[model samples]
Target: MSNMNVIVEKLLAIDGALAAAIVDSNSGMILGSGGSGVDLELAAAGNTEVVRAKTKTMKSLGLKDNIEDILITLGKQYHILRPIDKQDGLFIYAVLDKSKANLALARRKVLDAEQALVM
Candidate 1:
């Protein structure tokens, strides 16, 4: 299994990756982060709310499913938030350049990394 640092580094190796972080959904705290371009601290906190809101909505709708990932596409960037399967209250956040990153591959890579991640 990979450690936090290894996960972050591997994520950054993805083409067009700008930033990556492991965040605590419950506390809106960043556990580990790497890369540059965006402010990860702010992204972590804000995305925590995004996750919480989506979860709350899902519950309200009586959906008996877990989120695979949340994708936020912007004009210039793509933000991916994937909840960790083995660890509740934790997630992997990655930002990629829209023009340079392949969304499908990035998602697959994040999923692979998530499986190998050891909290």
Candidate 2:
């Protein structure tokens, strides 16, 4: 298993990664983070709401499945949220410059990192 710092470092290695944070959905807190283009502290809280809302909606719809990831595309960047398969209430938030990133590869990298992340 990799430490939090290492995981954050790995996330930053992705092309165009602006920032990455490990967020606790239950509390909207950033457990660990790296990179600098964005304010992860603020993003964590807002994104927590995003996760919670989606979860609630899924439950309401009776969708009996897990979320692989959440993507929010912007004109200049993409925000990716990857919740751990084995760990409830925790997720990785990544931002990438849309022009520089390969969406498919970035998603795959997040999944690979999620499996190795230490809670």
Candidate 3:
């Protein structure tokens, strides 16, 4: 299994990774992070809302399925937010350059990292 640092580093190894952070959703706080193109602190706060909104919407819609991840695509970037199943109220946020990232592979890596991560 990987620790936070290792997980962040592994994420940075992705072809287009610009930044990555492990965030606490309950507090919108960043626990650990690596890489830098965007400000991770700000990203954490914004993504916290992203998670909350989706969760709230799901509840309202009466969808019983849990969210595995959320993807936000911009003109040049891709923001991926993945909640860690084993770590309650925590998530992995990764930003990638859309021009270089393979979305499928990046998502898979985040999933693997989540499994290996220790709360």
Model 3, 46-106: lDDT tens digits are 8999999999999999999989999999999999999999888999999999999999999
User: Which candidate leads the pack in lDDT?
Assistant: 1
lDDT of 2 at 42: 93
Candidate 1 residue 49 Cα shift, in angstroms, is: 0.3
lDDT of 2 by residue, 1-119 (tens): 54888889999999988899899999999988998888888999999999999999999999999989999999999999998877899999999999999999999998888988865
TM-score of 2: 0.96
- lDDT per residue (tens digit) for residues 1-119 in model 1: 44999999989988899999999999999999999999899999999999999999999999999999999999999999999989999999999999999999999999998998986
- Kindly report which residue pairs in candidate 1 clash with one another: none
Off by over 4 Å in 3: none
- Candidate that beats the other on TM-score, 1 or 2, i.e. the better one: 1
True lDDT of residue 52, candidate 2 = 94
TM-score ranking from best to worst?
1, 2, 3
Better candidate number, 2 or 3, judged by lDDT: 3
Question: In model 2, what is the error at residue 27, expressed in angstroms?
Answer: 0.6
